[model samples]
Target: MPNHIDFVATLAPGIFSYELATGGQVILAMDVGTLVKKGSDVLVSTRNAVKAPDLGKLKQVVVQQYDVLDEREKMVRSASAKLEASLIRRFVELK
Candidate 1:
């Protein structure tokens, strides 16, 4: 099994992005303090591997720190969600 998985979370609106390996140590190391300071909404994007049934444990870890959204819910909240899906694709292509 892979020790780490790539996933995206909606931390803010203006594209505050960063990639740091948790080293299989922490499930989420998001700076909630900074997020609070920035007054950004916390919404986890469930568009990809994040919805895998095999990742239930991983999802649990994330759910502890942030709310998990299903596809239907995501569509309902589309106005507030950031465009991390496309951004991530562009990033991966760049790499």
Candidate 2:
């Protein structure tokens, strides 16, 4: 699939998040909960469709188009930088 190409894998103990783009046009966020690789059986929590939200699981699933997520990340990073700067200023002012 197209997503496989731009997919970035992140593995955190007890949680895993994978980012991919569908047909190189849409971004997909796949979160696998409680993954276990047995001798022969592999378990995964996945949505049924790609384009829409799948309420098949209890945990919240988010899938944003590639461009949307890029924008969000930029905004988040920008806000974070501003917050950090403010925090530092506060600390300096206290002294």
Candidate 3:
């Protein structure tokens, strides 16, 4: 049985569009420059080797983790990190 992939929850789902693949999808996790130029896919992930099943069920658990971490990390007074996060969010929104 393939592991279900809850990309939204684990990565902190935003108001963006997504394309699911039956019960089998893969979300590649990586770090890359955000909004490098313009109109870029920042968090681009290729289908993983593992096929996801029951994305809905997995989302509940993964989203919980995302929410907890995101909430606490939201408070950052760092000028540089703040700026970077801003750009990254924008990129994610567009992508």
Candidate 4:
């Protein structure tokens, strides 16, 4: 399957948010089979996709991606404790 970034890029511009709502609806409706099918579709579609770079290369890419932000912008975008906590929890669960 494609790496997460590529998969998301290919699917939709806001699939992460969309998926949360869609998946929640599916769960609430008790449609486990549909949810499984959706997951299977993602895996099948991305089975032959290119893999992402290793950690070091990805770090460089992240730096480059954020390089356009000036000091003020960086400050404005500075991490928040609440956001960090949520991200950390997701990261830990995913790992």
Candidate 5:
């Protein structure tokens, strides 16, 4: 599992735009720079792989990958909000 603490949650999602090899634009996540420059269809791996998946092996399109990223983003937002509220409550008690 990823250390959630490593990420800095933001008030707004970053603007993402990319085109797939199949010819369509949609976006986010993983090695974003490589994806943007190469514009290759991608494989979705819950874990890192030593070898990138073959083009024939890639199943999900760019939009589907973004959907997964979006769900995780929502979770992070909720966690950040809860953390902020708890900190505020503690600060109030301190005052």
Candidate 6:
């Protein structure tokens, strides 16, 4: 993922803002929502919620991929530790 600074820089140079329904107070990004910059330093309101068409399916795929990667990492670490222990035991027996 690109750094936040780099990501923002790529966006069209502009200041962004979003108006909440309850009050006139300008809350930060987290409170109000994601701000998108258009052309100039102009603030454009945007929806915070993702607009994925197949969000559920995408999420399931992502979770499955993460599980596979985690299991692979655990297997590699376990094998490495076992090999290290066997090597140490052999060295001690030779002494």
Native-vs-model 2 lDDT? 0.48
lDDT of 3: 0.44
lDDT of 4 at 78: 71
Worst 10 residues of 4 by lDDT: 26-35
Order the candidates by TM-score, highest first: 6, 5, 2, 4, 3, 1
Q: lDDT tens string, model 3, 48-95?
A: 221224556455645665676676666654666989999999999998
Alpha carbon lDDT at 12, candidate 6:
32
Q: lDDT of each model, Cα atoms only?
A: 0.42, 0.48, 0.44, 0.37, 0.46, 0.49
State model 5's lDDT: 0.46
Tens-digit lDDT track of model 1 for 18-90:
3335633223333322222122333343223222223446557456534544655777678445566677788
Q: Please give the TM-score that candidate 3 achieves against the real structure.
A: 0.24
lDDT for 15 in candidate 5 is: 33
Q: Report the number of backbone clashes for model 5.
A: 0
> Model 6, residue 61: displacement in angstroms?
0.4
> Given candidate 2, what's the lDDT at residue 68?
66
Clash list (residue pairs), candidate 6: 14-41, 15-41, 16-43
C-alpha lDDT of residue 53 in model 4: 33
Clashes of 3: 2
Q: lDDT by residue for model 4 over 1-91, one digit each (tens)?
A: 2233333323321112113324531111110121112332442232111222344444454455446546657666675656888999999
For candidate 4, the C-alpha RMSD (Å) to the true structure equals: 18.4
TM-score of each: 0.18, 0.40, 0.24, 0.25, 0.41, 0.42
Model 2 is weakest, by summed lDDT over 10 consecutive residues, at: 49-58
Cα-based RMSD of the predictions, in order?
Answer: 18.5, 12.2, 16.4, 18.4, 14.0, 12.6
